[model samples]
Target: MDRKEQPLVSIVIPAYNNENTIIATLESIRNQSYKNIEIIIIDDNSKDKTLQLVTEQQKKDNRIKIYHNSTNLGMIGNWNKCIQMSNGEFVKLVCADDLLDKNEIEKETGVMILNPSVNLVESDTRLIDINGKKTGSFKRYHKSGLVKGKKIARTSIIWNNFFGAPVNNLIRKSVLDKTGYFDEQFTYILDFDMWMKIACTGDVYIIHELLNSFRIRNDSNTGNLIGKDRETYVAEHQRLVDKYAGELQLNRFEYAFSIWFRKFRNAAIGIYLRVFAK
Candidate 1:
């Protein structure tokens, strides 16, 4: 399809003190094969050179729209701000430190355009380290196709969030409106919460291809949570399971299983990150 004929996609980036990786993240978006996109970046009062760097990039690309928050709005708050500022048929929340494959947007958009019933489309993710070295890959489904929203939600409740990160997914703005924004009550599992909500609304399309890279840095939020405040991270996961238990009609056995499964999963992930991801 001609770039002009394509629907506009909004790539909303919520950046804090990400001066190191912000430029790379922006470049990844700018290099996408999908030309019809608006790069909306919200700087959440970064204490570093994030704002200045983004401003410099903005001058080169007219499609880049930048906003600076007077005061620091925590991670989730900044994410919501980006969503509010976006005006596109589809929305993608890319973190300041992540990178995308050149054709990521083009392929994901094609899936959404072809499957109107799908409110979300997610692909496999390549995992990279702080130095941008390939560490591993995250591939959930064995095959790529449409999955029932309710089934996905239920599975999440039982087995924990397997939807990967925001970079791995593309969401319809209309569905986000219906599902609402990220829950502020969550710190570590905010994306997981939002994914479950979006999945409850409509079917989710899964693409088996790896279209994005999730960077793992020791100073990153998830990294810090898993390293220093692991107890809190586990608590947040439990909190979400509790919040959705009743709505999903989860039984006592299922609830109990979720709690156990999360602990096991956390342990396994920790081991993987330590042994292979390092």
Candidate 2:
């Protein structure tokens, strides 16, 4: 596709000390089959060669824009800074360690343009290790086939699906204006909060095709927060339930019970994983 014809895809990558894997991640974006892209890389005070490597690559590629946060703004602040700089109509919140498949942008972007009801579109991902070896798979809001709004709205099936990973999809820039960004105070569950807010606004579609490689690391937030993570997630989930109390189709007491049920189920999964040595 020509640069003028391609949808302006804004990729906000929050960088910390990803010196080893950042290059391959950005390289994947550079080789994207769908071209026109604005990449805003926020280097959040990495003591390693993360920013240095980007600067080297920056000189070679004009599409790569690098920003250095003076002190550590943390990932959330770095993420917000990238969004502020993006001028694209579509946005993808990619982690510094994750990678986009060669055709993911074209595939996901096309769906959103054709499906006006879809405010966000996501697809399945092939899981990988830091060494770029295939691991398993990761997906959020996945279904056997294409899914849309009313189904997404009636229940929290999507949340129950992948446990809530934000970058599983490409979101419209306008939706951010309506739903707001990640909750700054959340040490975790920022994506969960964002998804909850988006779910209430419009249809969120999950593509059946695999579109990216989501790297799985032991120390990554999701992996680290296993058994103990539910408490924090539960707190955030309850806040969403309360925030959209009217839309849940249940009274206050009923809503609380539902939230409790979901949390208990998540905790059970964590316990099982722990016992099974997964």
Candidate 3:
């Protein structure tokens, strides 16, 4: 069906100097078997030809809408604006440099609409190199299973993020409406914090499918901040553990680990880096 004839889904792509990969990213979403989509390309004051490229794509497809911020509000602020501008019943945030699997939205949305209780639908994702080449293997946090439907409880997210990043998930607008948007204060772990908050509202259902491609760019924020981000992530998480130590029995072990094991892991990383020159 044509986009006009079907239910619309607003896809927010926040771009900032993604000239190398943004075109491929938009193509993936455009090529999705699910035809009805309104892609909002919000330019975050990109100095590169990112805006120029988006403008060119906009002329090619009416379904593609373009918006530019007066000044760069960064990803968090731009995403908030995307949510405000969205007119779809469902919402999906696809980074300008990331690619969605052909059936990602159609598959995940079915799970949400069918399971009324499930507000968020997460799926398995694969990592790709900068050139869009497939990387080695499966993601660590998304446990392997034929789990057609499973809710992500608060415990699930905290444990996973403390272990790894949750990149390939499709969330409902309702979840965002209830739990609120990403915390801009957290430049790094915004998604992790938001997921934990979302899980508090209810269970996050996991649909076992290769839903999207997570790009592993060497120069990205995560890669750049790995050293400090790792320390900050652990410290902040340990702080959270301490704050909720009374309520969560699991926190008892976490607090203990915060003192001992978490430090040991950091020490181990230091040792490995020194030995391997990472």
Candidate 4:
């Protein structure tokens, strides 16, 4: 695609005290094969030098736009801020600690451009530790293609969030606008909830390739939620099942099974993360 013809993609990073990994994350986006992108970084009142480092990097790349919250909005609030501030054909919310492959945007954007019916495009993700070493992998589909939105929602409700994190997905801004903002009520499953909402509106395209690296740090929000507070995580997931059950046409048996299955799934994943993800 020509430089002028390529659609602008907004890469929004909701950063909070990610001083140790923010630069590397920014560099990954800066080096993307897709050039027509606007980097929106919203810092949630970090005590560290996250703002300063991003400011310096902004001088080097004019495409980067920085915003600092007056009061800390927390994770979900900061994410909603990034979505509101974005002005692009497609939006990607990449965590400050994660890294995207150079061709991540290019590939995901192409999929969306070719298929206007697709509201979201998600690819496989590589799991990396804080030190940036590959630990494991996260993938859902064995093949790449479009999946019905309702099908994904039903499957996800029964199983889990196979769509991975926000970094692994690209969403159409128009669809996102219709879907509305991320719900702040959700602490751990905010992205999962948003994905289900988007899937209800249109089809989802899945790419089997590992185009993003999700960094697993002990201090990250997910780490804290799943590691320190399993109760809240389970509660939020159960809430999703309840919220989507009727819309997805899940029967009482399916609904009951989903709730029970999630507990087992979470425990299995916790063990995997503890044993294999080391």
Compute each candidate's TM-score over C-alphas: 0.96, 0.86, 0.82, 0.97
Q: Order of all candidates by TM-score, from best down to worst? A: 4, 1, 2, 3
Candidate 1 or 4, higher lDDT? Answer: 4
**Between candidates 1 and 3, the TM-score winner:** 1
Candidate 4 lDDT trough over 10 residues, lowest sum: 269-278
Model 2 clash number: 0
Taking the tens digit of each residue's C-alpha lDDT, what string does model 4 give over 65-114?
99999999988899999999999999999999999999999999999999
On TM-score, the candidate that comes out on top is 4
Q: For every candidate structure, what is the RMSD over all alpha carbons to the true structure, in angstroms?
A: 1.4, 2.9, 3.9, 1.3
Residue 20, model 1, lDDT: 90
Write model 1 residue lDDT over 43-134, tens digit each, in one string. Answer: 99999999999999999999999999999999888999999999999999999989999999999999999999999999999999988988
- Displacement of residue 265 (Cα, Å) in model 4 is 1.9
- Pairs clashing within candidate 1: none
User: What clash count does candidate 1 reach?
Assistant: 0
User: What TM-score does model 4 achieve against the real structure?
Assistant: 0.97
Instruction: Give candidate 1's TM-score.
Output: 0.96
**lDDT comparing candidate 4 with the true structure:** 0.89
Each model's total of backbone clashes:
0, 0, 1, 0
Q: Which is superior by lDDT, 1 or 3?
A: 1
